[model samples]
Target: MNDEHDSAFDSVTSWIVAALGLLVLVLVWGVIFTFTVYSQALGDAFGLSSLRLSSIFSITTAAFYIAGGTIGILIARVPLRPVVATAGAVFGVAIGLLQISSSYLGLAVVFGLLGTAGGTMFVIVISLVPQWFEQYEGRAMGITMAGNGLGIFVLPPVWVWLLERTGIREAFVVVGGATVLVILVAAVVYRRPPELRAQGTAPVDVAWLRSNLTDGRFVSSLVGFALLWSWYFLLSADLVGILTTGGISRAVAATAFGIVGGVSVVARVASGEFADRIGMRVTLAVGTLLAAVGMVVLPWTGTEPLMYVLLVTFGIGLGAIAPLFSPIIIERFGPANATAIVGVFTVAEAATAFLVPIGLNLLLGVTNGYVVPLLTVGGLTLLGAGLFYRGTAPKTSPQL
Candidate 1:
């Protein structure tokens, strides 16, 4: 491990670079989260069923998470600048292509590309956090991840306004151009700590990763995390639809969804501070329980005030989980293999993301209401909380 007293640790340049990386995440995810706003527009334009439209998001989300596994390995080997710049460029192109997409297949293809780019960008930026800070790792991670919540909070409403003024195609063009510029600039500013750069890329220890994977506690933790993420993916993808179907105006629904983003910003940073004090396991369990409560109450929230309350409660849980991902992995496995370990965890999440949205959409088709599906998700979230609580047993292996 790098010495705590190294100049890079909590240095001004380090924080500046971290902030730029945070902005990169904001730009990348800002575009992706706008899907909630765009779904209605695209559905009307293409005359597509909800199931079909959801498939695009499901596929993209799955790709995004699954790509993390491979991208994590690449980040370990390659320089950060080229990898990030290329990912930004690819993501920009994919968004630009959305302007010309006339068919479902084309949209799906471009979205998948966008997903891959998002996954690459996310893993690279997040993995760098531990290398830069030792004493305040959790706080740094929390601040960085708050950008995700910030993006989700800020982007959807703007996208809705842009959609109204410029139409969907033109909005895509504008968002795509802006995303490319922001990402490239951020990429230039991101740098590995001097200590890490001096050491060069350490070869990944396959045996270590394999052994960790086989640990019962580690496996359980991954499963529990995946279940919690299943609820997140579904809620993020369907929140707008659920509200609109219940007779809320589109503008109001978008604002309500933005509230989730807004609440998440606070939840993420606060949870990180809490985790640094209490422990990741306890923090995770608390967050998951809150999420379960929010999900269970969501279906009954018919009035606007009740809906906002549920969104705030749910958002706290949603935001809390993001910063915890790296801390949990680093706590268990150490920073040497943090990216790869988190990548494996994300692959599990990808599997859940692949299945949950489609299953929820199908359930909605059969039942014609969200009650059953929401309840099931809530129940699963509770189960995840229990598993996570149980899985944080004493570590059996030495840190690599």
Candidate 2:
């Protein structure tokens, strides 16, 4: 009877955590990605140049990945609730600081703090969800991570509406305050899974990270995933340009980009379910191949229909990648190592996000065409698939 009751309780709370996790991601990613809207508003209000405004966003992005990884490693001993609550506090304080300070330097500093908080909170919630379920872990993670795409889709327009009515400062204050309240409330209600309640939390030590990094399998997997995933950043930065260069109208090109974001939301959910059935490696491999093929065909697209098909294919691959990240790490390294591995892996991803697009743009400038850059990205993604497959083959040793 007690076992039955506990099982029922676990089922109930698992879904609750999943729902709240989704909400948190939506708000967090929404705020992070919507900086473009805020950038335009800030420029008009402060007379800041594009470079200065861009530097602020770049600072925030860098801090998010770097600080998140570093702090995640150090905080492996801490419990979940406090880490989450701290993120809430940091968000509230950062936005409050931004409200009162008008200087560019002040804004940059506050934004970096915000990014750090965002990164910490994101990893904590991601780590939290998988702890609750052994069976439907993929589905729960998918539901939570779908918020990433959903936020990108839903929040920008909402922010644009808010900015028009409330002004930039007032708008941030409102949203930031609401975010704080929701996160703190979530922290209050969140609990560790009953199965894990008696076990000591595993510490992610320097030796462990070193062992994992040096392993051939681990190194290959990281490099392969990063290379394949580079397409996401590459296309996000240049997709419209690629379309326009092929004689598509600017409006149509934008529609193609929007399709990627919209399709990704559904793909995230679908991919999670798919991963649960066939296995993470196969799902990931298939997604990479689909995206690679799309990129390989990108330069030749002439009509709007073809553009949509290519973007949709790429979007599915991109969407599948996000939800699998935590699960894949957990499967290979164990749940104890998931947070730290995710943190470090995220840093690699951030580097690709920052550097790959710049390289693509340089190639575009040099060759004066999209075909070479597009094909190069596709080729790299295919190589990534090959490496990731070999690296993730089932192993007996419990190393990284």
Q: Highest TM-score among the candidates is held by which one?
A: 2
Writing each residue's lDDT as its tens digit, candidate 1 over 209-291 gives 67777977777777887887767878766888888776767788877767877888888789878877887667877888888
Please list the Cα RMSD from the true structure of every candidate, rounded to 1 decimal place.
Answer: 4.4, 2.6
TM-score of model 1 vs. true structure: 0.81
Question: Which ranges of candidate 1 are over 4 A from the true structure?
Answer: 1-7, 39-55, 95-106, 160-170, 197-209, 237-255, 296-306, 358-375, 389-400
lDDT of each: 0.76, 0.80
User: Per-residue CA lDDT of candidate 2, range 279-397, in tens?
Assistant: 77788889999999998898999988888788889889977777776777666766664567777777777878888889997998899998999899899989988877777666874
lDDT of 1 at 278: 83
How far does residue 358 in candidate 2 sit from its true spot (Å)? Answer: 2.0
Candidate 2: residue 387 Cα off by (Å): 2.3
Any runs in candidate 2 off by more than 4 Å, and if so which?
1-10, 397-400
TM-scores vs. true structure, each candidate: 0.81, 0.93
Candidate 1: what lDDT? 0.76
